[model samples]
Target: MSLTAFLHSRHGRGFSCRAEIEAHHAAAFRRFRARVMPRSPFYRGMADLPLKALPRMDKARLMANFSAINTCGIDHDAAMQVAIRAETSRDFRPLIGKVSVGLSTGTSGQRGLFLATPRERRLWAAIMLGCYWPELWRRQRVAFFMRADNALYRSLSNPLVRFAFFDLLSPFEDHLARLADLDPSVLIAPARILAMLAERQAAGGLALSPRRVISVAETLSPEDAALIERAFGTRVHQVYQATEGVLAMTCRLGHLHLNERWLRIDRDVIDAASGAFCPVIHDFTRESLPILNYRLDDVLIPDPDPCPCGCASQRIARIEGREDDVLWWPSVTGPRMVASEAIRTAIACLPQPLRDYRVVQQGRMLHLWLDAAAPGAEPALRTSLAGLARRLGAEPPALVFHRGLPPETDAKRRRIRVLPEARTGV
Candidate 1:
């Protein structure tokens, strides 16, 4: 084993030095190459190239070479079957390692299962406790809101840090009652839910002042951040966590800094010409399944300004919305394309009575799913929405009423979806 891995395994500590982190990654890559190259026929074909020179791998390639690539003998089919069972059984926690397994909702047709090693769970607990609640690790109640049941709780729950799993599939009332009784000190949830809570707090319907509110799973937009900050009555922290794992986080100034010790974020950019630039990541911490030079579908625009915090780890400006979420509205002259921010702006201008909404695109037709509690919302909302649609060069979409937007299994809230026909121009 590499010195860093050996040290980490033995001492349960992480390196803060940039050079040391880089060296550890190089060593890990070497071991990974040696182990997988000979056993996995797929990687064996690419063994001639330098370990660092191998092309970035995407989800398709990783899934295709699953059994061959995994350092463990866990086959792709078996792992997938476990994930499927977890999704269908209504049991959030399926055993994986000493931790639990939660399946991704697969909004983008790419689904993968996350494995949390026992040591990884401990590290996550320690880091989170240090960051969120340093005063008491075991005492403060933590209420985590996510679609899939989290595995970290199984390992880390203690008398002090009592964990209450609020399944996203459950009714909102169930969560409200649980929170009212628990009165958790730390509240971790998606930004949109916080936004809803903020609205409730304003109307004097909900009252729970949390010491810390950590928003993760989705990109925390500026408006969402402000709303969460106002509702929580505390500085809202952002965790750039996903199915992959905890990748980055906001420091004291709320700047998104890479977890350089565990992962290497490939910094790249898209010029005015290119539509999207995929990020290339090398996760040093992942040994069971190597994630070197893995291309992510999401796009992140790099920030030029140096963070005032002076942390050596690289930083990025606000994570821009994914390319897939872009909305194409119909204008009088042509089709007008706008991003999530633009759509958010239009929705924000509407009356606050609209509880929830979703915009779905099918070919040139847009579908608006509104969960409104107020009467006469449709008339006012329809007019405003249709005007915006026309401005975007998109025809008025068919309006649909949904009791509630379905929560994605991947922990991501899907505000929009593009049908296959739209991509094919059918």
Candidate 2:
């Protein structure tokens, strides 16, 4: 890690109030406007325009204009080729000059490309290490489980840090012995993977005593988090990151705080009552490929109360899967968003605990998969769901129970999902 980045990351730029955050954003934006914008051919002409005036960017559009959007003069086709080769071969060492290219297989199944320069990678390493490192003086083993490895992540490896990457594409059973031998001090993985490891530990098939456990790359439900914490005997810190940037991370108190020091976020509100909205990003730190006016479909429910940790940035209660994952139910006012939390809460209230469950909405009908001891659990679930619908002021969708949950996959585990077709049909 660079000395400057290490120093800055060790002690974050604390904000005393909302005004202080805005002032920091103003200075960052001023420097970005003067130095960063002119380099990108796409944003060069729009330097004087307000952030909102710039064209809105999503994965599709970002990939379409990748060549013009990046400040490093990296061609889209060339970068895609390099990234594809690395992904297919499982060798992530290839790079175009100093810029490393990687692919993101989003939940939508659409492939997206992300570029990071050497400086950006250094900053990322510094922030991740300086913030999450358990003990700086002691040599620590770090285990990272990810679908694909990138040069950005490799920066964590040094003589003082033994960074190991566990590939998700391979059979999970194969990793047991290697993981057991490594005895990582810091463990990081997707929430579901972490849950699986926790299950293994609980089953007496695995044993680990990691100082730090972090959940990344997936939306971690409260139930899963509780189980993981119980198994590991430590708080599970979460890093809400994307190809755009590290949007939010857990504070010392384990509260999710938006990374407002490097970027500004504009919310496109979906539900006014709950303060749920999609984040529109404006990252001043991403100079290589400026992520200005980039919008993400993931729904974030904001916490109105201040974080006890005293980070003045916004606190996100949870990252509710995607806009498409949010269930829509008919109401007197029209369709209302039935948040996943409500459904989880209703299930929690059931008299007989379900062994496992999955809720998938298929056009006005919900395929409720329940694994339980007795059939009476169905009626209890029905009653609980009906009560939830009433509380939300919405008519419940038809419930059709299945024997058990469908087979689990390494792909992101989302318990609640509303199909694309169900949105309009509902």
Candidate 3:
């Protein structure tokens, strides 16, 4: 497609009504289902079944059945070998036929490979640019920072769009220097890295005025967003992307809206009171590896009210960490699941400002690594956690405090984590 045509298709000038959005989603999903079911061994069995009746797929099942699950006919071992080599050498130019291979950060304890065809890569670029860049015709530069790179991300590099991938594994000073030299108009990175850059910008160590700043890969905490916006003097936007596909992005009004035009979300509610759910995504645009009724481990709080931006997509109030982060404590009846918010709220209510933190639950013990900006914060944190335990109708877990949290690996940071062995009522 020509640049002008692609822009027009994404902008969807005539797709303003809610009904129009629904119809478009339904049509796209039907077309995708029809095209992939016959080709994909994993999906072929459910070709004649309704989507709701089909068995739900998770990361473990998908990884185990990788070769059969994908319609691309690429062997699982071959894809993994290519993906791992790319990560090790930092050379992502290799591809399996026309399909690009990339690895998931394995934030949920298992690394998975994702495949995207050359055509699918271009489609992804269009959807991303349509969502984030209002002026598609204008020339702009984008700096994307992530642990790994692939052809799918590099496909956006063209005359109209100057795309540069910054390796997160490189030294911090090196990244800062390169970023200053590039002086990109659009900055995209994990929320943690963005927060660090905001600090650098505040200290006059970095010089750049990006028109658009997007948070990707990691959860964008409210604190991180506020800091980034304050430092850059621009609203901090976000892309709710995963290995699955581009699921959502922030609208012009700065609200996170689901990309329901190309993907459908089936909410698996984890907590009813706060409206937290694990989104089961059905992506219509991903043909290489068909993602149908794929359940994600992350938890999100859905917003029921319509967005003022007039976009018909569903809105999300916030992403409440991952389901693995939920604390499972023993209850009178059985092991009860405590929402991550409960622990986060306890820490946020502390007298001192928390610079960074990590909470891990092991059996009846809770380990906390807190970096507080003010003195007398540790005692306050302990007291708050005790209150949280009482509120949940459980005895307070034994607390252990560390001087500092360990540095995170390639995986996305999880402020709260519940050990796998921890039994839960669910």
TM-score of each: 0.72, 0.97, 0.88
Residues 1-426 of candidate 2: C-alpha lDDT, one tens digit per residue: 367657655676557799998888888888899999999999999988888898999999999999999999999999989999998999999999988999998888898999999999988888888778888899989999999999999999889999999999989999889999998899999999999999999888989999999999999999889989998889999999998899998887888989897789989999998999999999988999999999999999999998877778999998988888888899998888888998888787777767778889989999888876365788988898898889889999999988868776526777888777897956
Model 3 error, position 165 (Å): 1.2
Candidate lDDT scores, in order, read 0.65, 0.89, 0.81
Question: Which residue runs does candidate 2 get wrong by more than 4 Å?
Answer: 1-5
Off by over 4 Å in 3: 1-22, 329-337, 353-355, 370-376, 386-395, 401-411, 421-426
Pairwise TM-score winner, candidates 1 and 3 = 3
| C-alpha RMSD between model 3 and the true structure | 3.1
**Candidate that would win on TM-score:** 2
- Identify the runs in model 1 with alpha carbons over 4 angstroms from their true place: 1-52, 92-100, 134-138, 267-276, 327-339, 342-426
Query: C-alpha displacement of 339 in model 3, angstroms?
Result: 3.7
Higher-scoring candidate on lDDT, 2 or 3:
2
lDDT of 3 at 110: 83
> Which lDDT tens digits does candidate 3 get at residues 59-175?
888888899989999999999999999999999999999899998865765889899887888888876776676466789889999888889998878788988999999986888
Ranking by TM-score: 2, 3, 1
